[model samples]
Target: GGGTGMIGDPGGKTAERVLLDAETVARNAEAIATQASTLFAGADFTLLNNADWLSQLNMIEFLREVGKHFTVNVLLQRDFIKDRVKDPEHGISYTEFSYALLQAYDYLHLHREYGCDLQIGGSDQWGNIVSGVDFIRRKTGNTVHAFTWPLLTDKAGKKFGKSESGAIWLDPAKTSPFAFYQFWLNAEDESLGEYLLKMTMLSKTEIGAALELHKRDPKERHGQQLLAREATTLVHGAEEAAKAEQVSQVLFGEGTLEGLDADALQMLKAGAPSREIQTGTGIVDALVVARLASSKREARQFLADESVLLNGDPITDPSETLGSDDFYNGLALLKRGKRNICVLILK
Candidate 1:
């Protein structure tokens, strides 16, 4: 299990962090741990809380034993620390200043307890990692290694998170698997190659072939599809990834009513605008009730123009009625034009 060391990090961030309550931190730790367990299910892993050990250490003892290995000159040389020290108004706090040392101590604790030698993190942690490596060598005279992966970003160099709803969470409750899948499915063409190799477990040969396939038919999105499925499965389960793909096809790709399970229906119902209508409601009235149209006149006009569809089938008849028979398992899907979608619940 990897420890949640970066949760409170203020490094490279230009502002002070809003502190989270202990209960909130615990809940978030549990959620992040659950996601990690799913992502690395096959491996022997444990989820560690930095507060568990870090909180137990006496400040004086830490400064005496661990802190003595590094000098002030070296500590002040880290880019983020230098920037913070130089800033006048947005100056770093003692808590923020010692964060690197605390992280370095976390590495030493883990190494001593579990023989975990290799410390892997984002590129921003290079300075902190070196501190840990040096500390371990001074204390135990043993060699340790550190590896940092490049930070993932879009072509615009903006962090690859923050969807319309903000940070893309691993918790399905926070960011539904359907939206997560759509995020990858809509990857930009220029960043597709980098995302394919970095974010997925796809083989090099398979990626090479897919890149060529994507080039030949970029509109088909062969590479994006593969990356989407692989990445989604790696985080969420295979069953969820499949359902997400199916939901995509049914909603935006091709239209369908078949193979929709209860979970899939729940996702669709939660995502689309919906209302419950009586059994005898006319289609035009239902349309207005569902906000597919502003008025009966507009609803009728939509029908006349052949722009209204019920369950993906266009309804040209203005006099059509919806009853129990028109409902699929008590839910009816409505579409106006090609994009406006609504779900109607039959009561």
Candidate 2:
């Protein structure tokens, strides 16, 4: 799979991919392996790099043994391949055209060395998965299985797992646990059920209960909350999932500021306006400092309107002062309304 990744899977692409250099591919493969180790920690599976055998393949021998089994006519009929061939602007390259052969060989090698008989992938890989099954049967005269599930897509038919920022990454370094959790937290109501079924390991009974609760009040977003929790837990572990959920609740004004660690507060800081203020600062001054109000006069007006909150509790008194007790782990939150929040850092 690592070797195949280098050439890039052309199954779902509209144009030829820029091939990865050996060093980049190797680094990516290693990083993927590291992530997989944590993701599949308790699973009964062995990870293998396809490059172990694929890199050693002799071109002539591969053509004779693997390539000979596949016909150009069949390859040309693949949906992606056909689309590429028909599009003059982005025609398929020989390197990409041979992707199926390489993937087929991966299956053959796995079958011979590991007794693997089943290959599962997205529907987009239907052709490649079938090619593997057929190659295995042709090479060893043994039947294998290919299973493809529908790819998750948005209502508009574009693929899921991408945000306005860019493609979501499993690595927290690329997409923080908070960002990852938010992606699922914001799942559309129409697709929440499918996301729960495909993206989470929740049992049908559990999902049904969540859906029932959500139906009672979609405004509660119970289904999305459940999906977000389960999906985040699956990828980032239970502890981080809990932290992400807590941060989300705090940001949304549904949770208290107590018990948030520095990392969680740091994440919260990123999404809200922030300013430093001295201890015992008056609410009016704090509001202006945090930019929740443009001026002390306006800040007092907001407070008088009961539209201000200090650490999630509505504060209507301009005289109310933020002291050390108000800061949680050196940070506090100010709010003029549900959506306008600011982080207050102790100075």
Candidate 3:
């Protein structure tokens, strides 16, 4: 249910992870919990901290109970182990070596305690999942199932959320709703099908129909649009998703700011070039201050050429000053030419 396994991971890097302290782990757990709740909203679910059971596990008792079922040869042959075993200088540690055993016992405990029969996770967890299934079978003589999906990846095979920009955090504060929406909106066309199937709740029939429409007109980005809207709504709620989409549209000149809200205003403030200015600050000063223009002369040139847009309207007066009347909910959207954008936060 979580990525805590990464803490004991040997498959990812040549070196062992720098273990997180208790307080840091607990802090991250809260963030992960909030993300999981939103992404799985309306589902009946109970979260578990593997640390609760794993930490208290008795090592000698574990070897006698669960470790006997696994032969050293088979465990040594595991791909993760093979990678480390081949590199004597960076060989695996006992803690990481035994991580799979802890995970196996986890499945056995869930089976005995909760009647949990099926475990689903990424393909990278295949070895751990099998260990659990085998441990449960040897212990209780009951069969459990392990289902693994294809590892979600981009065209270059790098895992999703592990992009060049770093993990796409589920927290809205870390990644604003608008930015979250745009990540999917900007997904590569070749990767859309897999992303649609694995990441969204849309049915095959619907996705198929959309893909067909997209193929005929790739320029419109119908598939990417559907993926963006659905994925954003799933993570951030529909209302926030809509506001993000609206903010994106209004900023891009494709739509008006008629429905802009306070949340969207703050999103722009946090994400774009912005500066807090008192009401009635000179327009040229505001522009230079926000870095939309480099100097007063450049700011004046933009104003003269009708390249400055305030709240989606042309600002022709070079001497005009920003006022409360220009702000929407205490923030004003300022644009220079097509791509340069800034926000003036009313103090």
**Candidate topping TM-score:** 2
Scored against the true structure, residue 136 in model 3 reaches a CA lDDT of: 85
Say which candidate scores most in lDDT: 2
Point out where model 1 deviates above 4 Å: 1-7, 161-165
Summarize candidate 1's per-residue lDDT along 134-219 as a digit string, tens digits: 88999898889999988788888876543333467678887788888888998999998999899889889989999999999998
- Pitting candidate 1 against candidate 2, the one with the higher TM-score is 2
* lDDT (10s digit) by residue, model 2, range 1-347: 67898788887789888888999999999998999999999999898999999998898998999989999999998888899999999999998999998998998888889999899888888888899999988888999999999987876777855444356788989988888888898888888888999989999999999999999999989998899899999999998899889988998847877858777777887756788889988989888888888999999999899999888788997788888998888888888888888888898
For residues 1-347, could you state the per-residue lDDT of candidate 3 as single tens digits?
Answer: 23344355455566676777777777777777777887777899987777676666686888998779888888898877889888878888887887788788888877887889999988888888988898888888899999988887878998764434556878877777888888888889999999999878999999999999999999888898899889888888888878777777777756655576677766666666777888878889888988998999999999999999988889989879887788777777889987898877788
Q: Is candidate 1 or candidate 3 better by lDDT?
A: 1
lDDT of each: 0.81, 0.87, 0.80
Poorest stretch of ten by lDDT in candidate 3: 1-10
Worst 10 residues of 1 by lDDT: 1-10
Runs in model 3 deviating more than 4 A are: 1-7, 161-164, 216-219, 278-286, 296-307, 315-324
Identify the superior model by TM-score, candidate 2 or candidate 3.
2
